[model samples]
Target: MSALHFDEATHTYTENGVRVPSVTQILAPLNDLSFIKPDVLQFKRDLGTAVHKATELYDLGELDESTVSPLVQPYLDGWIRLRAELPFEILGMEERVFHPAHRYAGTYDRLVLLDGKRCIFDLKTGAMFPSYGPQTAAYKNAVEKASGKRVEGRYAIELRDDCTYRLHEMTDPEDWQVFLGCLALHRFKNKHAA
Candidate 1:
């Protein structure tokens, strides 16, 4: 069996001595964020990191309510509200997984049982995008292989700034194909890079 290690500082994974690209990295070709300013983008990215940490703490029952940042409180509220609306049993949170066959790695937000079916529920603080379809699908494939559980569904939940959420179920199997295509393209580019 190949060894896998996740470095928290870089949010990266190395499998059997090889550094692997993540799902987000593979999907980089789809990103068109040139419209957003650099400083604004940095702030959004920082907010996302903080919010994800808060939610992970909450899931692990380690969150100190009093210490929650005011800037991050709204997202936590939205996440909490989402739990109330659609109750789920969490199987894993912020789990780093690697797919040896594909030579890639990623961290999934939540592996859960929602509506009596095992599913991959990704949490996002930003607007729901089409790319999320394949993003969650990739997470599903890697998670199922690592955990030996058949993911029955793929969903992405957007936790809004107004404490509301939009839950989207990704039902297209082609999303997996899309992710594979992205992965292939990513590998090709990397291999031929100067």
Candidate 2:
């Protein structure tokens, strides 16, 4: 499959001239009215990005702990501690996947073999929410479609700021259907918005 391109200006993913919604875009409208400030949202996004980068580097054995920024160091440390306990083989990292059947695209964090099971590992650096299940489910479907392999498990691993972590196993078929509903809503919203 060709690499999917996201047009920042249009806020859409285009693959082979077909515009497809991203996982985030599909879930954007479903966010609860917590009234989080814009700067706070941006900060969280930045922190998550940094932590993901650090995790990727660590997985590839190219991480330089000294160069990791101070703000994300704690999260990185937590991930490191957690990674030590899990003996899994990394199949792919930061892999871009497209679902032709659903016409959506997303970048999954990692595909791994954990305990002889093919699973998707999604990393989070913030509070755990029910929406995360649907998000991970969507990634699982897309990744499975792209790889022609069945994903037997899905998980969300959260790296807390206190140098601790939580591993949540998310294997709910209902969540995948929920994501499909969100995709339909997203298409309707975007189609009318244009």
Candidate 3:
């Protein structure tokens, strides 16, 4: 296992002198077109980042609930509720892992032990989409490859605006294969574009 560094200027990950595609970058081209303005998407992305940061702090036992900003409070409350419902022991959070074999890298949300089951927990502050399966599966594969730990299940935890959350278990057997296809397409496009 190797450390992966993200260069903000280039918006890409590099490990061992090799540039690798992030999981989101690999899946970006497949994102559905939105009639909604680009600003809305940007807003959601920003909000998602805030919520994820708050959740990470909370999970690490460092979050001061009263200090959470008003704009992200609802999402924080939703995460609090979901946290109560989850009985898993958190093993990892917001940790970067890279697949040396596939040459891809990503930061997985969480790795947990639930009822003696090792699972990958991906937190999403958006609507559930089919892409999440491949996205989380790719994270799972990377983590398992890097840590030598078998992940028995993969779940998408969606934080909603109403202080609630929906848990979706990704059960697709071919999701990892699909993600590999996306990675290949991403490399092909970048190579040809250059």
Q: Summarize candidate 3's per-residue lDDT along 1-194 as a digit string, tens digits.
A: 47679886777899977888899989876678476589998998889989999999998889998888888888888889977987788999988889899998888889999889999999888877798999999999888888788999999998888888888999999999899999999889988995
* RMSD (Cα, Å) of model 1: 1.1
Task: Quote each prediction's TM-score.
Answer: 0.96, 0.92, 0.94
What residue runs in model 1 are displaced by over 4 Å at the alpha carbon? Answer: none
Report model 2's TM-score to 2 decimal places: 0.92
lDDT per residue (tens digit) for residues 14-98 in model 2: 8888777789888776676368888998899889989999999998999989999988999988888887888888999988788
Candidate 2 backbone clash number: 0
- Candidate 3 global Cα RMSD: 1.5
lDDT of 3 at 145: 88
Candidate number with the higher lDDT (2 or 3):
3
Q: If the candidates were sorted by their lDDT against the true structure, best first, what order would they fall in? A: 1, 3, 2
- Would you list the C-alpha lDDT of every candidate in the order shown? 0.89, 0.87, 0.88
The candidate that wins on TM-score is 1
Measured by lDDT, the strongest candidate is: 1
Q: Which residue ranges in model 2 land beyond 4 Å of their true spot? A: 1-3, 7-12
Candidate 1 residue-wise lDDT, 1-194, digit = tens: 86888887987778987889989989988788888899998998899999999999998889998999898999999999888888889988888888878989888899999889999988888867789999999999998888788999999888888877888999987999999999999989999999
lDDT of 1: 0.89
Cα deviation in Å at residue 100, candidate 2?
A: 0.7
